[model samples]
Target: MNHHKITSDHLQKKAYVYVRQSTLGQVLHHQESTDRQYALKDKALTLGWNEKEIRTLDRDLGMSGAQSEKREDFKTLLADVSLGEVGAVLALEASRLARSNTDWHRLIELCSLTGTLILDEDGVYDPADFNDGLLLGIKGTMSAAELHFLRGRLQGGKRNKAERGELRFPLPVGLCWDEAGGIVLDPDQEVQGAVWMVFRLFQETGSAYGVAHQFAAKGLKFPKRAYGGVWDGKLIWGHLTDSRVLSILKNPAYAGVYAFGRFRCVKEILQDGQIRQRVRKMPRDSWLVEIQNHHEGYTTWNEYLANQDQLERNRTQRPENILPQAAREGLALLQGLLVCGKCGRRLTVRYQGNGGIYPIYECNWRKREGRSKRSCMFLSCPPLDQAVAERVLAAVSPEQLQLALAAQDELLARDGSLRRQWEMRLQRAQYEADLAQRRYEQVDPDHRLVAASLEARWNKALAQVDEVRRQMEEFCRQQTRTFTEQQRQQILGLANDFPRLWRESATSAKDKKRMLRLLLEDITVERGADREVQLHVRWTGGACEDLTVTLPARIQDRLRYPAERIDEIRRLATEHTDAQIAALLNKRGQRSSRGKRFTGKMIGWIRYKHRIPAVELKRPDERTVAEVASRFGVSHGVVYYWIDRNILPARQQAANRPHWITLTDAKARELQDWVQSSKRIAKRSLKRQSA
Candidate 1:
């Protein structure tokens, strides 16, 4: 009846039809193809299959068949064929089922083993036969090749359009295409203002988060383009997010540049055996096409590149690769800019003391990472901060005159604006009062009912006028009281007295930090011996300076001994003992150069170190037997014998003092004869003792 293989068994089993499209765009625009595939159910019914035996798998209609795992309908069709349940599989074309040979041939192999028939617009064939299997394999391969050729042709056309910067896509917020086929800024003034404000605030604050915060603080909202739904192509206002601000800043379209292939779709296989598509942002240099000055933009291309560089530098957590981040509000001057010289890691700041008045910088990255904490450096905040601040001020001092003049102009403008605002309020109040009076006057006195209410309204308007006038007077008075000529002169003189301006209480820490960040890129600190710290500062313009600063003296600072004190101790050791010398030093309110109270043992140690002997002192005219023996070149016993025999006159100044020997010239002559006689007597006694 038909040149198609069909049997009772095939008729008893269900027939399945699989349908798919490469993209949702195709499914929407090529409805004829989808209808043709879906109409395969009628074909199956006409092939002796009941309505209950006919099945259609259309879940993959808008999904690509490049990878079968992503097409659940294709998987279900293959499952039925492999289980020998599907009698026949039908599609408008073989490519509609699968565009991959690996998937298409696998389906054919399963259908062949299950004795199922494959059908398409061409014809129906039983894949179980060798001839049918060979023919279907060729068809499957040709279908896969056709799919590739179609995709290649489409991609070639897209790339050609992109190369000429003519490919159209959804534009970012604040940009639109006109009827003349030219790019222009969003016609909505509010949208343009919001976009421009984001760039301006980023330039001032140097941070995306800062821009978002400023808008939030000002109670302003940013507009985004509504892409779909009832409000499509309309402006939707919402709070500005950091990511949104960053995206606006990073987009080169804001710089009037036509860029293509900024991002590409990447396919990844999931753990659950499905393919997922992700969008990856390509590097700027890797973009396929870029055409500057192709549209109206808020900034120049060079400015756009600068903004990108700034955003890259703002990554404080990645300090190892880029420069430090902009300053944040904190007590410490160098917050994100401090790097540990020892560990080459960023230092963390911790606020200590009551109310966090004292900030301490510590490099404890290793400790936090469960590594060794032995190589950390610690530094107090104030001394190091003051050193860096002085350096910064010195560097910027040459510009202080210009800065002061600018400040004066800014202040004058601000005051003028305030006065103008107050004047406007006063004028408005006066106009209201005048209007109320006119309305009251227009009502005749005979109309007392309307006159009474109008009179009350006039009185209220007059009261408001008076209140505004009073407020204006108070504002003027306060303005006059605030800035005197002397104060103005002081502000002008800040060029010569920058320290005063820098230390003024009116200067916020945040402002100071911002100033520092403008000049300094980073500061590497290393601890040195004797409470000294060395700072290696990298400036914004690639210049570096090393500064060595001594830490502030504390109550617990170690000190050294003074040379004068040591000499005095040595001289005193000759006359006084260790204890006496220590007592004398303590009495004189002298302390060890180390700031410690000296003791007898300390004095002894000093004496031993200086090689100064301890000499017991005597009265000015008093001497001991040892002294006399040393003076006369005689033994101490001989002197003792002379003193016992009273040959020499001796007297003691006090019991503790040594004996005083008055050996005058006459006594010296007599002592010499006595000594000669003692020698002869000693010789005779020695002879007798020998016998």
Candidate 2:
């Protein structure tokens, strides 16, 4: 028993008994093992150590000794031994201290230096002695090797059971054990319905987060199975979280497959110089066992694989640049589907205008890489979106009739859900009204105080019932007011008329954007010669369509005006003022070559540029304000109103003098008509207000 290892010097110092259990389950259920470890304190006292000198460390009771980092009690014991404070280190076995050589050897080295004795049920060993040290080293090595063998055997058993679809773990929501102890769908219809709804919605929306959002919007909760104690296996309802939805979606079990080893333990060194373990997901192919069609499930294995692919594609931050992302609720129809032909990079969408109604597609790849702005590819969204939409409509016209019928069915289904909600509200209100009336009738009329309150409550409840009834009637009326047979026929007739449908208020921008993403894989735009943009459309099936689209020229892009228009403008500048020239040019439909309507300022600019002389209006026949007003059969104020509004031109000789108005008979007639039109509008507005 190595009695020589125990010395008086060791008895003078404290004895540290390190106790641990590998798991919480063992700590709770394996009380005998814990008692055995703690009984080592009596062993230390039997070895001539006083009761006060014996200290038990059970802080690592629910922690694994396979790694030393998590064992704080073990660390404290080692520190005391290294500081020459712990004279004897006692444990139930070497494995209880550590199953790793790094930890065991370190503790042994510290004990050897501190002249501490190691004790267990077998015997006591002094690490300073060569024979005992060698034996303890063997014990430590064997302990670590035993752990490896035990783990391998357990893992092998698990894999075998999983391959046979017999291994059991915590089932996700909607699955539970049957009376016969076999896995089956949850007996609760609501739980089963919720689980099925999540899968159905994911199928419809092609997004896990979208499914959670749908549940939240509908005020529906997801069921989670409680794991332990009184609540074990019970269903707990909560608002569905995105991660929970994703977990459900990603689990192979939901697809009737038994899969194991989806995750692997990884060791990481933390900032505190300790090892940490994390469970990281492994690739599906790397899973140790996968048995398909193991049980009844919500989806097929093939559908599960498709869902995985879809989720991968839906990621906006994929490292690979080739994959397209899900459609965002942005104004740009081609937001995630556009690419720059010149740069071979994705184009970013920038929204402008009030409410971000206008979208601009720009390639900022080079700019992001710190290149000059000249490398950017820019295109206004309206023209490009129109061009692409026209092409898409042409490509999809054959299926438009089928899609229209399906859309009509979807609308009816949505209305059915809404109608059910209204009906529920109506029923609730009717019940309240009936209850209030019954309560009022039961009240004694002579007790006026209570009778009055009950009557008022009854009246309020009646009002609520009426409001709900009216709302239900309105809803029913709206449901009945669907598209007429003739309208349906017209819609069918114009199934291929996408332009008209796109412009219709019934079509949402979101639906349009989703439609574009579904049809087109990517559109590459490159600047071409002669103010044209070359659009290379890659359709979903790898079909490519190339089109040359003309970019609208800006006013500044016009090199010069036509020589004939220029000569007319110059001549008009000679006899007419700038204002008169503009009016005359506009009346003759002689707009600027840039397609802008001529204004007085534009006329002056052209006249000044060409060195044209200003016109002189000094003739006696030129009518002044009072003369013009008399001629127009209107007041002086009306004439002045027309002049102020630029309908007529007037000049002043001095601030105090009357304004001189020059008017041809045509001008005088236009003024009279404008004044009469304004009066009629004002009179009509007054009549409407009074009515």
Give all candidate RMSDs, comma-separated. Answer: 20.2, 25.8
Q: For candidate 1, write residues 636-673 as lDDT tens digits.
A: 77787787788877875334545667667787777666
What is the C-alpha RMSD, rounded to one decimal, of candidate 2?
25.8
Each candidate structure's TM-score, on Cα atoms with residue i matched to residue i, is 0.63, 0.66
TM value for model 1: 0.63
How many Å off is the CA of 316 in candidate 2?
1.4
> Which stretches of candidate 1 lie above 4 Å from their native place?
1-8, 22-29, 112-115, 125-134, 317-319, 340-380, 394-494, 527-532, 550-691
- Local error of candidate 2 at 513, Å? 2.1
Q: Candidate 1 — what's its lDDT?
A: 0.82
Show where candidate 2 strays beyond 4 Å: 1-12, 126-132, 179-182, 340-345, 352-358, 362-378, 396-494, 525-532, 552-691
